[model samples]
Every structure is written in C-alpha cells, then in structure tokens.
Target: MVTYRAYIKKDYKAEIRWEPDHPFLAGLARISFMTVLLVIPWLLLGMKAPELTPTSSPVSKSVITSQQDRIIEPSAIDNGLVIDTAYLPENEIFETTGLEPPELEEIIDPINDQVTEAAWQSVVVSKGDNLARIFSRLNLSARDLDAIMALGEDTLVLKHLQPEQVIQFQIDDNQFKSLKYPASLVTTLHVVKTDDGFRAETLTEELEIRIKHVNVIIDDSLFLSGVEAGLSDNLIMQLVAIYGWDIDFALDIRSGDHFSMIYEERYKNGNKVSEGPVLAAEFVNQNIPYRAVRYTYEDGQSDYYSETGRSMRKAFLRTPVNFTRISSGFSLKRKHPILNKVRAHRGVDYAALSGTPVKATGDGIVTYLGRNGGLGKAVILKHGGQYSTVYAHLSNYKQGLRSGNRVKQGQIIGYVGMTGLASGPHLHYEFRVNGVHRNPLKVELPQATGIPEEEMKHFTTQIEPLLAELDNITAKSGLITVNSHSDLRSSVL
Candidate 1:
C-alpha cells in the first residue's frame, strides 16, 4: 500500500508528498503481519499443543460379540420420529461424521432412459405444408430434419404432403422421437429413432380379394338392370367391354337379354374398400350367349378370354366414343344440315357432349393431322398399308399426337366439338379399306393374339368352376336377384 500526505501553510501555499514501497520488502512485511495475526488468535484461545497422533480406545472382545448378537430396533428421537440408524452399516456412520460428500455427474443413456414413453401428436397436412415446415412448427432443429431425411430416397416421401393426410409424431422433451406416415391406403412408413440413428421401414397390409357373383335380367336397359341388380357403373362398363368384341351395344341389346358376372372385390380389416377386376362374365344377346373369363399367364400378363381361350380384345374397339346416340348413319347422298344441299355422307356421326374423349379404334400411325374442308381438327390413322381410320370435328387433339406419332388401340386421340360445317358436338368417325369408304358399324375387325398352347391347361382349370357357377345361376330361371347385403354374400360364398 502507498500513502499520500499534504501540508498547509498560513500564506495560502500547500505542499503534497507521495511515497511508494519497494516490491520485495513490502511482500515480506505483508506475509509476516498476516502470520502474527493468525497465531495471536490461537494463543488468545489458550490452545497449548496440536495433537499429531490419532488416539484409539480399545473395546473388549465380549462386548463386540454381544453387539453383533443383539437385534437392533428403531428408537424414538427428540422430534418424536422413529429413527432406523441401527440398520446403517458402520462405514456409513464414519462417512456422515465428516464433510458432506461431493455430488456425482449422472450418465444418461437415451435408449434406456426412464422417461422413454413419448407423447404422440398427430398433425393433418394442410395445403402448402412440407416436412421442414412441420418440423419447424414442432420446434425441431434442422440437424434433426437432416438426420431423418438421411434414411434414404424412400424417406423423401415425407416431402409429398397431401391435404388432410394424418402424420403422427412421437415427441419427448420437445425432441423428435418417431413418425408414422401413411404412404398409401394399404401401406405406411414407420420411422423410428434409435440409440445409433434414425431407421425407416415400409409396412404394407395384405387386402383380402373375394369373388362376387351377380345375376340380372334386362327389363329396360343394361344400365338400369345393372343398377337394379346392385352392380356399380364401373362393373357394368366392364361387362359391356368384355363382350363388346362380339356384340353391338348401340343397336343389338334386347330387352329379354340377361347376364351374369363373377368379379373380384377387395376387403381390408373386414371392410370392403373397392372392387377389383371382372373375373368371369356371360351376356346373352339375341339368344346368343357370349362367355368371357379373365386369365393371367405365368409371365404376369392378363386379359379377358373366351371359354375356348381365345382373346376377347379385337383389332379395334367397337365404339370410338361412348355416345348418347347415332346422330346420322353412313349414307350416300344425305342432305347436309349446314350446306342445305344433298352431299355424300361417307361417315357415321356419334352425338356426344362437348369435350368427350375420342379414342383411336386401332393401333396405327397418324397419317394426317390438319383441318379438312368439312371435317375440322381431324386425325387420320393408317393401319398397315390398306386400312385407315378418320376422326373429325374435335375440340383439340391429344398432346404429342402428330403426323408420325404412333397411337395404340383405344387411346384418346381427340375430343368431340362442333368445328367446321357441323351442327353440334359430335364425333364424325369413318373407316376406309383399300381407299374405299366402309361402314364402321358393319366392318369386321381382326382378332388379337390368344393364349398360348402351354397355358391352355391352366386356363381350362380356372374357367371350369366359373362356368359351373354360371350354369347353376342360369338354370334357376325364376331365381330372384340377390340384392340384399347378406344375400349377396351368400351368393358369392
């Protein structure tokens, strides 16, 4: 420590002085003063000599033996509480007599932690929501997001968030633990966090596919009869498609014609989810029975086939478009509605709603795509060297369909519209062979490839039971259609 002094004189003059100590001498003096002060406290307390050696008191051997043989009991303390100090080991008593023990740092294993159960939180995906946004909403870090996405490409499915899809999260202490994301109607992706890292797996459910049989009598129309017989519109369309190769649905369907269907229906968790393909069906038109069965080959290719294993698919679909009615038939000298003059009508006009899809009847390459004089927005397909098909009066052509692009059979090529000299929205379809116009409704189409000889035995075995069931249903002419829920089940079983 340094000291400053000031001296005042009577003549208004003042003198100031400052002194500093030498570092080595000041350090020795400070230590000596602290040592004397410490010893003075001890001397004033009358402390004589410090005990250097610890003292021990000897106990008799008989006393130690008696203490071990006695049964100690809890004794009442001053606070009226029972104390059980007698059960504590002697070493514990020695430890408690000294200073308090030091606190130990705990080691926590995440996987084996006592607080393992996580509270589940469910969030429905909303529009414009993504996985990162959801993670941020849950106060999760970007590092966690990266770790989860590291699961692989399949884990990226979390990025495709659909509105209203439920995504579940298991969170503990505001940390992400696991996730349950429904990948599809029958599959879910389960992502879990482990001690090492995040793990992901796809869990799928097996749906039960059962056969269903339905018999219906045509009273007014196929649609009405199918609806009355408890058949979905899709199933009815499939039924018409199976036999469309042999029958003309627009003109040949009779009121007395009847049909039977054996199709596949899928169920999940004891509840029907949706309908599958038509396994077998029979439609009698004009007293002619047309039977078709769906068969799958060993190579995993499948199609509808006849009872003799012949393919039901022809070279062309019967109707180019599903239409309301035949507005005009193929004619030779029909009066034009727009021109008001007798003109040679070479094609059939199918009346349909505007923007209805028009399909290519056969697999062929587009030969022409331009606006004709009367047939506007037209497409002409050349099948082989001799056969050609024309579709006219379209709203727009199918994207990517050009002069050289090849289209398959029943592929949408254009839409119906009232373009160029036309009356309303309708499809003007024409078929030509050897550069000669032919009636589309009457022309015979080629047959597609049938089942191979090696697969014929398997095909026969599968169709036998389906045919027997059809025959049994047909034998009961007056048997009512099973429309009730339980009756329908019985019919299939």
Candidate 2:
C-alpha cells in the first residue's frame, strides 16, 4: 500500500514506466505521458515570441538598445580619451569579445525610463487642499516644498491649488525626484532635483488653434437656438459680448435673427484642450447685419473691425447690465410703480436678477457714488465733456469704487438690486448730455478708431477669407460644447 508520505517521496517516472506485467490502464498512462512530453518539446521549439517593431510614437518605460561587443566603464571613461581598434588583427567591420558589459553607474538626472515602475504618482487636490497638505499626504517634508518654492516666481503658481487639479510627482528612495504641475492647458511647471539643488522651469505647450464655424437662427431665444446648433455657453457669451455694443440681446434679439461665427478651438496632441478667442463673428439684428473680425497689428495690438474698416467697439455700451426686461422707459408723463403718482421718468429701468453686474457704459469718472433722493445706492459718472450716466438700485457697489475714481467702459461699478423704492431687483440707468436726459436706446454713440490707411490693405486681406467663410456656410453649420474640465491657468508664470 502506498502511504501519502511514501507516494510523495517516490520518483513519479517509476510509476509510469511501461511493463508487460502491469495493468492495462498503467500501460496506457505511460504511452500518454511519453506522447505529451514529445508534443510539448515540438510545440515549444516551433513557437515564436511576438516581435516588437518600432512605432511612430515615443517609446515608454524602456529604450531598445542592441548589445555591443565593447564595454563602457565609468571608471575608465575620460573626456579626452580615444580608443584605436587597429591593434586587433584583420578586424574590418566587427570584433568578438568574451567579457560581458559592466552595469552602468547612476546618472545625475533620473531618466523617464529609469525612474522605477510606476514611480510617478498623480496627487489630486481635495477640498481645502493646499501645497503643504498635498506634500504632507505624500510623506514629503516641509523642506521639500520650501525648496521648490525657493526656485523662484515660476514655481509661485504651485502656492495655490484648486480642488481636482492634478499634481504629478516622482519619488525615489523616499526622496523627491521631480514634480509636474499643469499651470494651464498649454503650460506646465516642472521641478526636477539637480546636483545644484532643485531646478524649476516652465514648459509651454504649443497651441494648435483651429477655427470652428457656426450658423444658427433664433427660433425663440438666442441661447436655446445656439445650444441646439451646438454652440457652447462660452461661445454664446463671447458672441453676446462682441455685438453687445450694438444690440441688446435681452430685448432686441428676434425670432428670425440669424447668427454666424468663426471662433478659435485650441488643441494639444490632436486633442482639444481649451476654447480660444472668437476670430470673426456676425450677428444680424432685425435685418441689420453687424459683422466684426478680430485683427491683430504688427505691434501685437488687436481689436475687432468691420468690413469697411470701422472699429466694432462703440464709445458707450448700449446696455449697462444683462437684464431680463425693460421695466420702464423714459416718459414725460408716467405712472411710478412705487409712488403710484404721475411723474416724469427720466431714465430706463432694467429689471434683472439681483447681483447681476452693472457695467460702466463708457470711460468716465465717478461724480457721485451715494444714495440720491429716490435712486438708492446710486452711482453717477461724468464722461469727459458732455456725457454723464447714472446707475441706481444696486445690491452692492464694486469693492473700491468711490467718487472721483476713474472707470473704463464695461467695468463693473455696481450690481442690480431693489434697494429703496423698486418693485423688483432692477437697475435705473439714465444717460444725460450736459445734465439733460436722453434716450439711451436712440442716442448716437461715437465710433472707435478704424484700421489705419497703411494697414487697411492688410486688414482686407486678412478679413476677406473670414467673411467669405461665413457667407459660404450660410447653412446650419454647428459649433461644439466646451470642455468644462479644462485647466484654468492662463499662462506659465
């Protein structure tokens, strides 16, 4: 009888050996074993390993280096050294060696491949996460962060981290080897450990900006139609800003008005990273077409211009705030909603959700920034010689706006609110010429500087193709949704 211990100690080949006195099952088992042994050797000898051919992309983790006959030892390496192979007899193209290559000495900088398996780790910023907190979680000392910050202003961006922003790091033997922070979609900050200490550099990625086209007709609202036409909310806001000086989108956009645009879509490595500025756009408001193309000059100054070389920007913004409705218009004999009495309405009341930004209509200085008799939280601005504007009924003023403070056009001076005597959150806007009230909607706005005579030819050459593309795609050409999870940093530093 074969015991468990005895069976384990016995040589298995003996049990399978063929013998005429053995049982028929034992003989069959021996034949099957021999066949399997022979078949396995044959199959293994005939099989081939998969060949690794080079691809168009960069190789990761390892470099394919062929073994050479010669050896390179660091101890024997001399900068001015040269070896002569002439001593070997009759060696034309190659030589044979018996010795194996020596193991390489450590390099000063850890190459991407030599950094150990999965050495690089991505650290995600959590709520209330900062650089100190992130470093602490990685078991990194405060000195490491201080050393990184000491690198200079280029590394200053790492001081602030937003939630969900990824910070990549590499560690070797509990020592910080390198760190990479994405400053923006097109810019990355790299910190590498060096012999001199830590080195910081900003690596900027080239932006491949491709122009995307869109054409949509307003069936109800510009926003609704724009979305259906594949326009991103970002692009829609850009479109509104471009034509905002001429058209009040809140009230003036009609059911049939069509919008066309050619804007920028920034890309990296064939993948889109961010949305760029609108290159050229056109908005036909009430059958009146207003076309604008962004033109950059030799000095790097850029602004939007019309086909006739007229500047797209007006002296004053048509609407001071993005409001839902025009609660009241200018009238000599009107019934005040709060007072319930017939009075002269000297200004246009713009009803908006509370906290909507109220912008300055033009470049001006604040003449008054206090509550008037009925205009609560009022701000009065004097524009150069003749024009002056009034904004009232605000929830709050811009942080530091004061009387005599200079304000540029489109600067937020206050917010929409119902402070003293208003039915809803609204902005009471009054445009005056030499202290006399004028209809803001009907008042003629001054034109900005157009293309210079010297640059007009260049402007036409650059702008013609953009205009043609808009005209050609008069059909329903759609835009795309923006990538919301994009890097927010604007530049490298």
Candidate 3:
C-alpha cells in the first residue's frame, strides 16, 4: 500500500510538471474551465449571459484576457454591443462620447395666477393754503374730507399746512387707498383703506431738543463782530429781540456798546438749523451796564430776570427812538443847532428822517398825545407803578392812536419831527421813575423773574454741558485773556 501511495504521488507530481510552461496559456485554460463551469448552470436554468456592448452593458467588457496587450472587440448584438479602443477601457466609452443624459422635466400647475400691487405718490403743502383746501383741489370726496376733519381739532390745526410740509397720498386706479402724514415739529396722522373701510393711525415723533451756547463780542460793526465771534446772525438778532421792547437797535447802539450773551441754540444732526430764546445777556451802552437773565417757571412759562430776581423787563424801556442817528446828546451847556442858546437839555435827542415811526418803550396807557409848550406833537405813556415815558417832537401819530388808548411794549406811537424845543427832525426821549427825572441810560431798572425753583434742576442739567462747550470754544479762540494778578487767582480759585 505504501509503494502504491508513493507511485500515485509521483504520478501526480509528473502530471503537474507536464502542464503548459506559458503563464498566458495556463491562465487561458483556467479561464476556459471557469467559463464552462459558469455557463453550465446558466444554460440548465434556461438563461443566457448578456453580450457586452460598448454603448450599453459595462460588466462584460470589464473581464479581459490574460495578455495585457490584447484588446477585446465588442460583439455586434444590438442588445449588448461593445467596441474595442486603444485610448480608453470599454466601460468608459459612454463617458468619452461627451453626451449628457436626458433630464427629467419639472411639473408646474398651469392654473395658478398672480397679481401685482401699485405704489403711492407724495406731495408737500405750499404757503397760504390749508390741508382741506388742498384735499378739495385734489378732487377728493366730501365724505373723505369730513372723515379727516373728524379726526381731531388738534389734527386739523396740525394740518393747517405750512410751506414745505410734506403729505403723502395712496391711490389705486383713482380710488383712494390711504394717506400718510409724517410727524415733524407738528402733529402727524396716517390713514389706510381696509375691507371694513378707512382706518386712521397716529404716529408721534419724540423731539430731541439740544441746546448750544453761543457768545459774541462786539469789536467792530455788529454784523462783522457777530461773524468773527462765531455768532450766527440769527442769534445776534435774537439777542437784540428782548431789548426791542427797550432800545431801538437802529438808533440806540453806540460805538463802544459791547454785548455778551448766553443764548439757546438748537441743532439737528449736529447742524445748527434754528435758534431758541436768549438765556442771559449783558449789554453795555456808553460805559453804562445792562444785564438780562432768562428764567423758566414751574408752569413752563419763561421771562427775563435780573441778578436780584427782579424782572429785567420794566414797565417801560428807556427810549422809543428807532432807526435814527443821535445828532445831539443831552448836555448842561450847549449850543442847540436851531436855538443857539445854552439851555438845560433834559432829554436825549435822536435825529431821523421825518415820518420815521416812534415806538412806545413799554406797556402803558397813553396819557397825552397833543402838544405842550415848546414841545410840538408829543405822546406820553404812563407805565405801571409810578413810571412814565415821553416821546416828543413828532411829525404825526400812528393811525388810531390817541390819548387814553392802551399801548403794549414797542408799539408805534408817533414820528420824528422838528417840533417844540426846536431842533432838526429829531426825537426827545425822557424817562421818569416815580415822578423823578433819572438818566435813562444810567438808571438801575427793575429786575425780571429769576429761574423758577421747579426748573432749576432741569436748567442746570441742560446748561452745564453747553457752558463746558462754550468754555472750550473760548479757550480755543483765545478770546478771554487771563492775567497773572491777585484778582485772576481769586477768580480762578
């Protein structure tokens, strides 16, 4: 049995040695045997392996002969045709053709529809016209106007329509859609049309009031001095506003009448648009001093005051002469231009053209308007609490002006003329406090109310920052010069 086993082992080893020496031939034989084995089951089950086509089947062309240099040509069967190529593998034939596959189309509903909306237009109000008239001119229905008017009386007044005030209208095919009124320094309203009819809306804008301090030092002309001191002409006019009741700027400002003011300036977006009231001011005329301080009360009313808490505003101002030159001044001994005599000059003389209107210096009842000895065409006003002002030498009186008629501060009473106590066409102004003659330019007038106690905290908070800004500006401009003296040290400390 051992010898027979050894002979069988030797025969098997000899059979292995007799196999083909070419690896290609050996691999071919093995492939043929595996193909036969794979085909038998397929054939027995009544199934046939698909023929490979270059444009179709990719699996059949993937299997290759053992020789790398040999290429397989595809079969000509229409079901699965394949082609041989020197450039690329048969599986990549479809990709090399550079043809994109057909894409599936997206489905959309054909019955859907869409509608577009329209836009609105805007308009601004012009001068001397109200909103109701504007709406009427636009051909809006009376019902709509009535509806708008019914919103509120305040709303109607808000719509009183100042120049450049903007208003918007919304319409759809000539039918009213809505209306929009933007808030400004005035009230604003908005209305919209809905299924239930028109609905109104109110939008309020919170006003941001910012204060700035502006100072002006008169050096040359008032206009030039204001420009040099960074004071806007508007602010300068405002500084002279309060004094309009007292002094006529066109006639009263002297050459050396320097003025200092702390006034309220308003700004929007860091740009100054308008100015507020003058807060505090000091005006010096011919070496005489006058000061005014503005104060706000608990009830939100404001007035000018003196340092001593009296009204800076008196029952009367010092003079009524307006837009005139001081051709002559008060003097104890002087040659009058017309009289040529040394006479007691009791009043200051202002020279102006004839028919130049003279104003009453304060609120008072007109006591006299006829004439006096040597004084032609005079008007006298008796002010409150034993004070009176007289305007003499007039061409005529203002219309409807007569004795016993009440006059407010700065009311026009008469005109300039060469009347009694003769000179050229000039105005002689006199001030009598408690029936005693006092120097109109030098007398200490009664004071106005001071800053109210309730508004003190608000004023301080608002004014501190403005004062700091003013200090910075003054320092930068070198307007305030500091002297190394004991007084300076005391002031600084």
Q: lDDT-based ranking, best first? A: 1, 2, 3
lDDT score at residue 274, model 3, on the 0-100 scale: 58
Judge candidate 3 at residue 278 and give its lDDT: 72
* All-Cα superposition RMSD per candidate: 34.7, 25.0, 40.6
Model 3 Cα RMSD, Å? Answer: 40.6
- TM-score for each model: 0.64, 0.64, 0.56
Better of 1 and 3 by TM-score: 1
- Please give, for residues 1-493, the per-residue lDDT of candidate 1 as tens digits: 1111122111100001111143643564576468667854443222111111111111121122222222121132343443222334444633533323222222232332322365456777889999999999999877888988888976988879898677878778888888778898798887777867887778789998998888888887676688678776567767766665666554567988888788899975444557858888777765566778889877887899877777877776656886767787788978788888888779888888999999998899999998998898999999888889999999899988899999998789999997877888989999998999989877776667788898899999978898787767666655443321121111232
Clashes of each: 0, 0, 14
Among residues 3 or more apart in sequence or in different chains, the pairs in candidate 1 whose N, CA or C atoms overlap within 3 Å are: none
Where is model 1 poorest over a 10-residue stretch in terms of lDDT?
9-18
- What lDDT score belongs to each candidate, Candidate 1 first? 0.69, 0.68, 0.56
lDDT of 3 by residue, 388-462 (tens): 888888888898997899998767888898788665687878878888766665665543334567656666665
Against the true structure, candidate 3 reaches a TM-score of 0.56
Least accurate stretch of 10 residues (summed lDDT) in model 3?
1-10
